[model samples]
Target: MDKIERIEIAVIGAGLGGAAAAALLDDAGFVAHTFEQAPGFDRLGAGIHIGPNVMKVFRQIGLEDELARIGSHPSHWFSRDGTTGEYLSEIPLGDYALKEYGAPYITIHRGDMHATQIARLDKSRLHFGFRLSDIVEQDDGVLLTFENGRKVLAGLVIGADGINSVIREKLLGAERPRFSGWIGHRALVDMNKLRSTGLDYERCVKWWWEQSRHIMAYATKSDGSEYYYVTGVPVDSWEHSESFVDSSREEMDAIFGGSHPMVQGLIDATESVTKWPFWNRDPMGLWSRGRLVMLGDACHPMRPHMAQGAGMAIEDAAVLTRCLTMTGVQDYATAFQLYENTRRARATKVQTISNANTWLKDPEDPAWVYAYDPMNVELN
Candidate 1:
């Protein structure tokens, strides 16, 4: 009879952060298992941008070529006026990222990226429908109790369950997700349907921004077959949570009512749209609580103005693995402290800036964000 190896790390949640954390730890010689509340693997709601910062992590982990093949590579990020479509500013992304940051700015559907990483993991180690109930710290490890009444003993716990995380509330006390008074409507449209509008669908990521409202569209597939679009507008109040039932065209029109023709055409091309009320968290000085530590949205959920919620999580996972490797997993106190030391400042800064500037503004210089490398960065 074969002996089953005990999991050394328990990663709560199977979203991007949780799955990626498990993959990174497993690659670094840790027996990590991901526990997800969902019974089966599925796609999250929208498309996502992978900045150079996060791409470098994928490059080092040997998924760069695979990512490049499946995702869209945009040459620039173009900002324009929402009503007039006048160019405000431009930033290089595609080759710029490859040459300067050693990676490419890739965009892909959320499901594709999650599935790619999940496929690399040992399926036997993944447990679904194990909703977290409570975590009890022990001298040797931590005991995790799931709502299903199953208990698991793991040497370490990573809280990557995302916003409204059960682990964070249990470990750090209850924290509510602060709504940003913003409603985000997102859709994926066929590029061919939008090509007749005469907008340069392949030129750059076209962002149309107006006061209190903005919209952006980009090609999401390599062959320019589909475009990912998101429109953000301020609401007086947001009682609705995130959902994706079919919306009336009148409702869609009301969101971006007076947008430019180019923007409207993109909207018209969209057949389905999902809306999610933007939510974020206040800055935390630290996210470590003894043997348990938090990462991603579970720790620092930020506004989407920066398009970096996933980037920060991936960076956190990489730096955390490095910290554990350096401090030795037995000394989790030192490891978690080191991880927080390296991540807290960066995460807080992104959260602050993303919240303060909730619209896509042309950066005076974006290298501060795009050029950062977690591997080479010093632990502040």
Candidate 2:
């Protein structure tokens, strides 16, 4: 039997953040396990853009080529008017990311990306169906109580559980996440229908930002299937997913109804549409308490305008591993503090910038976001 060391890490939530954290710990010779509330992986959501900063992390993990082969590589990001269909501004995406950032800019179906990362992980380390019910920090490690009535003790527990995290409430009290007053409707349409509509399925991500709504679509999935997401500034809060399911299509169409033909067409293509009020946290005041720490959305959930939510998680995995390697557990305090110091500023920056990007009618320059490079820095 291979001698398994007793280094235990409990990653709450098996979303991309939790999975990445687990993988990084495993790579660093720790016994890391992930517990996700969801019973199993189900393909949810339409698509997500993967900026190069996240790609660089994949490169280090040896999964870049596989991801690149499966996702759509766009040359640039462009903006246009949702109604007039007029070009606004564009930014180079391909060679620029490769040369300047050392990785490629791509977009893939959110589900596909999730599956790719999950597949690369050691199956033995992942514990599905272990929904976190509560957590408490002890002198030696963190204690986690799961919905299954089982208990887990670990040297460290990281909350990658996401925006409505139970671990966050356990550690920091039950605080409500701020609703952004937005309902997002997303779907994937057949590539043939997208092309026949005269939409350029290539040339980078295209966004049609209108007065009160923002609509964007991009080619995704392994095969070039495209996706569209429309968000209307919400007028009220939705109590549950059932509320979204019960919303009237006429009401949905009223909000996004007259944006543009292409926008309307994409919404029409959906077999059925789902809508919900979006919520996210600005950077939290504290990320760690005792051996418990928070990562990604659980720590710093932000608006999706900059597309760095997953990128931040990937970066967290790297920095967390670096901290563990450099500062051994003899000084877990110093090591955990170092992890926070190394990550807090950058994570907050992404959170701030992503929230700010939503209001920019046209960005002359990408500013806070354009200059980030993940591979250039190594924490020692």
Candidate 3:
């Protein structure tokens, strides 16, 4: 038998959530090692919204100011009619967010944000190319086997591995995620072409059509040079084997052609686009079992309609770290329970609202979502 390495804590998956978990755990003075199946990550063509709720978590990890500097701070979240170009709602978020929500709200390229996160982690403990192949519950800890033939004994395992998490499968058995009968077309439009239309694009806007079909567009940079959009459209089914399929401007025109001039401009500027099927799973009855626990998409996967999917995941990391700090690692069961108790209600609420696709469609107070402070929230 190969000599198995022993770690105080193991975090699977080095994506946004897992990276946050590892960083928070480290900040809490815990010796947590992060393992990623992939050799490394890239600056993929994607963007994300960081609300004040999870920005507090980033603040704890010393990332808030840096991220705020790199991202676009939209004055409001504007929901507009797709065809008429009339504003349905405008929720204040710039200075108002700073005053009311206790932090800044920004939209940034996902890759840029993720790269910033990965850079702050302790590199020696962050292992790459270690795909989790098997796990065995033991008397002292969980024995983890990687596809690379490396073995480890982790005192506690956090499955931040995402919707197709292997640790989730270990807890609930193998089950594929359910398709939500929706697909999102994501693209970064050509800025020059968009500018040629001579129409001022809002920093952040969601153009809505019938049946809740819409395109959420925004700037992904501080200078407003890079713009991105993701559209939600109902579909019968997803038969593709790959994660996403190539899309084109022609397809954009076919679906959203002859709408508002601004909408028309976005379609005309589309250079490259891809369509992805949204996958979901009902909130699980189990968040932790034995020495194994889960966070982020591993436990509560939801649609991106509310743009809180990553926010919720990062919030989980903060709460979970605090719970462990309160109880200590030896009392992990109690800590895990506290983490779940504190997080379940809020996470489930976001999941339900996001799936309904009705958040910020009309004027309403978003205080509950944006004002949350995961770092300071009382642990249950």
TM per candidate comes to 0.94, 0.90, 0.98
lDDT of 2 by residue, 146-222 (tens): 78777877787778988888777877789978877666666667767756656545646778888767877777754
lDDT at 112, model 1 = 84
Which candidate number maximizes TM-score? 3
- List the RMSD of every prediction in angstroms: 2.6, 3.4, 1.1
Evaluate residue 318 in candidate 1 and report its C-alpha lDDT on the 0 to 100 scale.
89
- Go through the candidates in order and give the clash count of each: 0, 1, 0
lDDT (10s digit) by residue, model 3, range 258-303: 8877777887888899999999898889999999999999999999
Which residue runs does candidate 2 get wrong by more than 4 Å?
Answer: 1-7, 196-200, 241-252, 357-360, 367-380
lDDT of 2 at 7: 40
The best candidate by lDDT is 3
Clashing pairs in 3: none
In model 1, residue pairs whose N, Cα or C atoms come closer than 3 Å (at least 3 residues apart or on different chains), thus clashing, are none
TM-score of candidate 3 against the unseen true structure? 0.98
lDDT (CA) for every model shown? 0.81, 0.73, 0.91
Give the runs in model 3 whose Cα sits over 4 Å from its true position: none
